[model samples]
Target chain A: MKIYEFAQAPNCRRVRMFLAEKGIKMEYVHVDIGKGENLAEDYRRRDPNAKVPVLELDDGSHIAESVAIQRYFEEMHPEPPLFGRDAKEKALVEMWTRRGDFNMMFNVGMCFQHTTGFFSDRMRVFPEFGEESGKKAVQFFSVLDQHLEENRYLVGDYFSVADIGMLCSLDFGKAVKLRPDPAQYPNLVRWREELNARPSASA
Target chain B: MKIYEFAQAPNCRRVRMFLAEKGIKMEYVHVDIGKGENLAEDYRRRDPNAKVPVLELDDGSHIAESVAIQRYFEEMHPEPPLFGRDAKEKALVEMWTRRGDFNMMFNVGMCFQHTTGFFSDRMRVFPEFGEESGKKAVQFFSVLDQHLEENRYLVGDYFSVADIGMLCSLDFGKAVKLRPDPAQYPNLVRWREELNARPSASA
Candidate 1:
């Protein structure tokens, strides 16, 4: 299998971290998103959206979307399952994962895009929207902090893709200077500290 | 089982349509989001996010997130599976579902929020961002149109949650007057027509 990704992209990092967790090895092709390489014709053919972290399977089929790629890996490597083991467990994991994606990851990404004009050459930049998105990202951190105060992980006792989702979101938040304040979001701060200690966290 | 939802919300409708497709019956409790009823303390206790389409199980536990709610039902009733029958198919279904959510659904939601101030009682609105998001929704329709021109369904031959997701997204697009133009997105237009013909589409 091969993955076309941008190393620092949060979405791409989510997949890489998942792979690291599973001790899986695959060919990694860096897509220089900053240079508009992903928008090239060949890459566009692989993923019409021209997004990073496109996983090409051994059979030549490709999967986009970070969570979908993680699901594929979960199915291929069932041990240390990052999704869940049962119906309800899976649903809980997915619920939290979606929350992290929409509330934190997506918001932070928008904050960066709108504020920094990181991809201004390719897309319009709205600084006002970026500021609002940055505020929303911080608000989501409070939500996560509250949840983390009671649970070891996003769902429950075990590490899951939801945790990875949070890790990626928090890491990406740094770009927009939306990091959690240790005093204001102690639980989230503690959770991030622990997660950052993991080998897969740095992957 | 019970579902707390607003009838016209696209995310809520995704679950309603899924339930209709599976022929599952559940008690429906309407949450008047426009009236801020979902913001009530009790509702917030049930779902911290206070988002609509919260599925309260028979045991009183609840699941949030439209896709997660759909997955719960899919696991409980495997027939007429909306996820997939195999790992690869499941990944494909998830990938498309996520795309529809991120590209079409979320953009339309933002456009509605930013332009119309649909929730002005609770948040800020930015008309410029709303217009940009509306354009992005149209661009996503073109992407879907091109994909549908080659494939019968979002993934392959069979209908899946991805179709349901697209259906909900297109339905919500009507709120922002962002319907797919046949001249610009013929395949998407055709696909939406067929999906709308389904009884579940109106659920």
Candidate 2:
């Protein structure tokens, strides 16, 4: 099995962090998304969506999307249980995972793509919407801050894929000039500090 | 268990359809989103995100987000599995699920929210982005149409939540004057017709 990924991409980092957490090692194939290599016909055949961090199984079947790739491994390695141990915990983890993807990652990505026109060669850029999305991302930090005030992690007390999702997204927020203001979101900043200290964060 | 939702919301409908498919009946508690009832403190306490289709378990804990709620039951039921029966199929299903979400549902939703200013009371709306998102939605239909020409379902011959997510989003596309043009996307239209024939579609 191999992972086709651009290491700098936030979604790629998410998959890497997940694998690191599970202590699962695999072959890595670099897809240089920055150079528009992902748009090439060969890469598109690997993943029609042309996204990085696609997991190619031994049978040559490919799985795209960060959560899906992570879940594939989670199912294979059910040791540390990053997804969750039971139904309720799994539901909560999934909820937070989706929340982080939609509220944090999407906004940060939009802010980067639209504001910087990073993908202008492929897609249209809308700076106005990008500006609004950046603000929306900051608003989510307030919500995260309040939630983190009572809990050490996004769901319950243990580290999970939900935290990993938020960690990568928030870290990637730097490209868009987005960061939780320590004064305004002290709890969120505290949570970030804790997650960043983890070994998997470097993945 | 009970569900707190606005009947007409696409996400609420998605959950209702999933339950109907699973043959699970639960009490429905309406939260009138059209009148901003979801923004009320009580509803916010029920779900800090203030979105619909929240499942309230017998123990009084809440599960927000359609996928998470559906997954909670999926674990409990595990019949004719909508998520997938194995690791590989599960990964593919999840990949398609996230694809339908990011490519179709999100674009349709952005078109509705930004173009119509339906949620102007709650958030900023950018019509330019909405227009572009509508075009992106059509582009995704082209991709779906081509895929459907080869397979009956998004992942395989069997129906899964990926199709459900697309079905609800495409149906909701009508609100934003978006639909797969039968002449242009014949395969997609055919696939839609098949899913629409399902009894659970009306849910």
Candidate 3:
């Protein structure tokens, strides 16, 4: 198997970490998103979405979406199941995963797009809505702060994909000036530390 | 089980369609998102994120995220599954489902929340993201149109959750001036009509 990846993207990093945690080895092909390599016709065929972390299976088929890639890898290698065993447990993982997706990850993308004008040349039409995305990221931090208050992980007691998804994106959020203020988010502070302690978390 | 839903929300309507297709019965509790009811303490306990289409299970646990809800219901009653059977089939369903979520449904929420400002007060402080959200949504339609050109349904020949997710969202998109130009998206039009022809699609 091979994975087309980008270095700094949180979505790409999530896939990279999942591969490390599961002890699976895949040929890694770096895609240059900054240089517009992903936009080329050849890479577009690899992923119609033209996004990073496209996992090409040995059978020649591939999976897109960071969460789906994690699921696919977990399914193919079940020794350390990041998604959990039972249906309800899986649902809990998914619940938190989606929460992070909707709240933190997506909003962080908004922050960069709407405010920094970092990717403006690549796609610049949404300048009007850019800063609004940054504000929404702040709002997302508050909600996540509340969630982290009771649960050690995003879903329940165990560390799972939800943590992975949030950790990567929140780290990226720092680049956009969105960080977890310890004064406002104690729960997030604790969980974020635990995530940082893991070796693969650096991936 | 009782569903807290709103008719205008494609996410909420997804659960309705799943139940209707399975011939399952459930009581409905509509949360007036327009009135900021979902942000109140009572509803927040049900779903901290304050989003709709929450399913209060028989066990008294609550489920959020339309994809998660669909998975739970499908597990509870597996006959005539909305998610496909077998690993490859299931992957196909999930692959397309997330496409709808990422490429289409998520953008629909952005189009509404970021552009429409229908629930900006309740959702958070900013209303400008709606403009970018709306444009991102139209971009997604083009991606879907390209996919529809090759596949009969979103995944396969049969109706699945991917179809459900996309159908309700695009229909809702029309209200926000995000309609797919029929001339450009002929495949989408054909598939949309084909999907609507189903008894459960209208839900």
Q: Lowest summed-lDDT stretch of 10 residues in model 1 chain A?
A: A70-79
- What DockQ does candidate 2 have relative to the true complex? 0.82
Q: Please, what are the lDDT tens digits per residue for candidate 2 over residues A1-203?
A: 99999999999999998999899988999988889998999888888889988999898878999999998888888889998888899899989999998899999988999999889988889898899899889989988999999999999697899999999999999998898889999999999999999898896
Model 1 misses residue A138 by how many Å? Answer: 0.8
How far residue A6's Cα lies from its native spot in candidate 1, in Å, is 0.8
Give the alpha carbon lDDT tens digit for every residue of B22-105 in model 2. 999889998888889999998888788899989999998899999999899998887769998888788888899899899999
Encode model 3's per-residue lDDT on B1-203: one tens digit a residue: 78898877888888788888888888989788888888899898899778898888888889887778777778778888888765556666767777777777776776676566676665453344556567777777777788788889877676788788888888888768787778988889899888778787765
Tens digits of lDDT, candidate 3, A1-44: 78898878899889888778888777889898888898899888
Off by over 4 Å in 1: none
Poorly placed runs, candidate 2 (over 4 Å): none
Q: Scored by CA lDDT, what does every candidate get?
A: 0.89, 0.90, 0.78
Query: What DockQ would you assign to candidate 3?
Result: 0.48
Better of 1 and 3 by lDDT: 1
- The all-Cα superposition gives candidate 3 an RMSD in Å to the true structure of 2.3
The numbered model that scores best in DockQ is 2
Candidate 3, residue A27: lDDT: 86
